[model samples]
Target: MSPEMTRKIFLYGAGGHAKVILELLEVNERRCAGIYDEYGAATQLLGYPVSGNLNDDYKAADSAMIIAVGNNAVRRKLARKLSANWATVIHPSANISSRCTIGNGTVVMAGVSVNSEVRIGDHVIINTNCSVDHDCVLANYVHISPNVALAGNVQVGEGTHVGIGATIIQGIKIGKWATIGAGSVIIRDVPDYAVVVGNPGRILRMNEPEDVAGK
Candidate 1:
């Protein structure tokens, strides 16, 4: 059996999103060795150890990690580089249909509801209270922010972020690395690297290369 079965999970960030993920671990009664941040941003988080380097608390074969950052692009970058095994955290309160498929390292936060035929890719985040309807396809590293509502057959591409309180109607397609701003109502398709905002979801700007996918 894999040594990772010992109940310890390692987090790869130290930030507000990390805090929320840490609590999810707590709620599930999982033990965390510490938080690993190469930048040395923090030394402690909610009483858990924060290490500048990935510590030797667990053996490499036993280390199960979850990218705790909120940024979709950064999460994708880290997922590609991090050699550790992954963990997917779904809050106990989340109502995810068994018919849906959630890839490794994904997180379904509290109060979230995912309907049947939904395909959520690796390291995606369905944030608190979000409603993902039937047949939605969420590509890798996508972040569906808190309170966002995705109607049936909606497709969100890689590293796309649907901001808090945003609503996308049925059959909408949002492209890679796109940003749908908070409270926006998406009525049409969004292209890659597009920054969309407002009630009618107008294109505000395009993201630079550094902030986009494959960066």
Candidate 2:
């Protein structure tokens, strides 16, 4: 469908984060079809209806979606299961290079800078004021929180959460489902399901396997 014709959006997950995303969509004058969250028993969220749970029937609508769930792995799973042409929401103020590859259902928040040759996978959140340098590969469902700085050639695996104000040095590999604490400085590789904290990041806790997958 033509860009103009593709206007309606069904947002997944109705929570605090979804509210923010909805506000962004409204600022752009985009129509919200509804929301579908497994946890949304509430009739309305952000002045929009909770249509139903996300399923094949819900997926039939022509409207695209932005998966607003905070959990990276859940977002990734939802993105993979979504119907064709999942939506990418980029705030008007986001600075993204033409050479960057942003996948479907991703959101590039306001004031974010994505430099050249960056590959951002599906349902990712590049949050406010974050600076991603050149040659970064962010896998599906990654969330780079506000004010984070990722140097060049950084590889963030699927479902990783780089906390707000965190800094990652160049050429680092952050494994899947890893959680970096806010204000942490990560200078080395992070293992899967690890929670790292402090000035120079180190593993504080290892997440249970089920927690990583939401099982």
Candidate 3:
């Protein structure tokens, strides 16, 4: 591994998302000095010590960090608090076009494809097997779940969760904190905090508890 690959760092979460990031750290040959989670009292993750607080010591020990929280809002909030340099994590197997601009603290998981002119904002999660086509703009803290397909020029707002197998048509705009239900086909613009579901994705609720998978 190159020296860059072995750079020391801390993780800012200890949930399921953090576990996946741990695997990535190992693959890149990076050393994880510790993990900090306000909710995690556990001592270790994959044998790395878990530090409870986001201390000055932890922040000063490393120059890089990955926000491994699944909830986009929480991740963004903590990221601002840490204020460390954001590290983008792209799996080696992912195919991202040269024209794509991925902002810091983003993770492009395996089998994901980001086409030309795609602008991915900070702390976003583009999970496995997702396809983001040309001219798409994903704002900060957006989570595109596995098997989701975003057609061209789709604008996803901040902290939105596009659930598994969701299909967003071209030129559609999804608003901030909106929940796109699993297997829904969104053919139109969705308003902020709307929970839309079903074929063609009609608005089911507004400003509701996000877990549209249960709806």
lDDT of each: 0.90, 0.85, 0.85
Using TM-score, give the best candidate's number.
1
RMSD (CA, angstroms), candidate 3 = 3.5
lDDT of 2 at 203: 95
Off by over 4 Å in 2: 1-5, 53-61, 80-84
**Residues 1-215 of candidate 2: C-alpha lDDT, one tens digit per residue:** 56734667778888888988998887777777778877667778866888656655435556677887888768767766766457788888989999999987888888999999999998889998999999999998889999999999999988889999999999999988889999999998999999999989999999886878665
Best by lDDT: 1
Clashing pairs in 2: none
Model 3, CA-based lDDT:
0.85
**Local distance difference test, candidate 2:** 0.85
Q: Residue 22: error of model 1 in Å?
A: 0.6
Which tens-of-lDDT digit does each residue in 143-200 have in candidate 1? Answer: 9999999999999998998999999999999999999999999999999999999989
Position 128, candidate 1: lDDT: 98
Model 1 accuracy (lDDT, Cα): 0.90
TM-score of candidate 2 relative to the true fold: 0.90
Query: Higher-lDDT candidate among 1 and 3?
Result: 1
